[model samples]
Target: MSHPPMRRPPIFPITEAQLVSLFMQSFAFGVHALVFAVCMHRWFCRFQIAGLGTKSWPWMVVATSLFILGGVDVSLNLYDNIIAFVFFKRPGGADLQFETISNWINIVRSVLYFLVAMLSDAALIYRCWIVYAHWKPRWAVIVLPTLLWLGAIVCATVDVYYVSTLHKLATIPHEKTLRPYLFATYLMSLLLNFLVTGLIVYRMRALSKQTSSFIRQQRWNRLKTVSRIFMESALMYTLSVVISAVMEMISNDAFYGTTDVSVELAGIAFDLIIIRLWTENTREESRTITESFIMEPPPARPRLNSLGHYQLRFPPPPSRVSFAHSERGSVHTNISKVRRI
Candidate 1:
């Protein structure tokens, strides 16, 4: 008869660096979420109060909500540190069930990231509709929006595919060839974002050409506002790419935890930008309108006691005058004859 001994579990795989990153990521998310919420609230509430338009409000809300969801999603991932600290221990002391929860949290986070991307595309499309209302070049008005919608579909599909596949990879054994493609998919998304924004900028410029100076200026100002927001997103997108690319080159795991952080940072930054820019643009526009009203020339006062009829102010030159003398044969001769008689 022989006796068997139980085995002990391994130590946590996370390094001290990962722990620092997690804390930083959560802290950044908190700060970003606060700023974005403030900006979005101010913008949407302004429109709601103005009563002129509410269309942008709904889209803004949806977009901001996605960003909020994204922040929440990332924050949950940071919670993994706690789970690892608490539940993971020597063999038989901790349950594998928590690992399943962790995996699910990851899936949800990816989905939210995808949603945040989708909402950004949606917001851009809305902007295109606003700025490119007249950017009709044969069929752009129809085709542009269609392309935007299609881009959303494409982005969502790819993200879903990647997330689902990666999730399944954990359970089912598969060829390791698909790993790099996951990162490639991420690049495709960044490209989509960049393309959408560039198109908007081009169309804005084109649309500006067809408008009055004032409206054109307004649209250009809007362009700058939107561009700033897009730039924020762009910065995050680029950083995420760089980090992931470098991770790939060096075969490092730093990107695994940090990519999401990059995204969350970008989300918050963009959302705050959207809110602040929208609010500022609205105020600037309103001020422009108010100033126009204030500085408008007074209604030309009508001259009092004015002769309405058209009259020549000067007489014409006199023509040469000829008066002919007429002979007056009087009856004086008859009167003289009668007096003599």
Candidate 2:
């Protein structure tokens, strides 16, 4: 049997500069992940769970746990990205085959991140709705969350499709067409994330302004504060978005470095920061509620009102007043007679 012609080895085309950048990105991701995990855990334990106890302790626990899970999932992605950079380079073929096993690993990891991102987004959406709550249509509430969940699903689908296809792009030859589509998908997902967060902030402000009730206003202010934290956390991802856009323009590996390492790390950091903020605020809210109850006096009963003073027990009404003029006249007559004598 004739042996097949020896094929040229795949080139992993990269320079020392690119390797250095990738390493820097990996280091940044690792450090951020560790920091986030530690800080977020502390935050959840200290503030989030305890704070949530005021409104709905059970739900708060669920949300806090979910938030932590999301943080951890993203951290895992950062780790995977670092590993991929270390072992796999585009120019030089990695010892491990790209399509055979690596693709599967990436797919699984991406799925996890997808779930996490979706859950975090959903949690935020739920909280926003809670804050904006009133006589809103049932369908409206259902629709918003459903839409957000759909966005998450779409993002995950696109991520899986494109990331998995990346390995077979060489063999399939048609994979080049998918690149723009992949970019579009990522952009859409990012946009959705930004838009959803923006909506929450906007709604909170609007509700705050429209409400006439003092109680509602107080709640709205709390939501507004939370929204601010959320926005700040989101600002980190905004950097990621900008960096990713610039990278897309440059087509340089360094740009990729920003998205995978720096941006990811930054996003994780913001998440932990927000979690801490939420925890602190929750504790403060609970304290405020407790203190208010302790300080306020109970309403007095209506029966407590007396003619002269307020009392708890009922009292008889005052009797009518009568003049004592005859007695005064008799006393004056006796004094006049004595003076004449």
On the 0 to 100 scale, the lDDT of residue 306 in model 1 is: 57
lDDT of 1 by residue, 59-148 (tens): 456656766676676667667556656766755322342333226655676567566655655665555455444334635543555565
For candidate 1, give the lDDT: 0.53
Clashing pairs in model 2, backbone N/Cα/C closer than 3 A = 11-91, 11-92, 12-91, 12-92, 13-91, 13-92, 304-311
Task: Note the residue pairs that clash in candidate 1.
Answer: none
lDDT of 2 by residue, 1-341 (tens): 99999966433222332354456655765665565566546545554444333443434454445445545544554454455557666663432332232266556655654554555555555654554344256347436555756765775587577667655523111134434644654565566657767766676566545432423344445545655776776677556656755554544434434544533444464455445555655565587689667656555455534476666743443343222454334323322221111
Computed on alpha carbons, the lDDT of every model, listed in order, comes to 0.53, 0.51
Q: State how far residue 260 of model 2 sits from its true place (Å).
A: 2.5
Which whole-number lDDT from 0 to 100 does residue 13 have in model 2? 25
Superposed Cα deviation of residue 172, candidate 1 (Å): 15
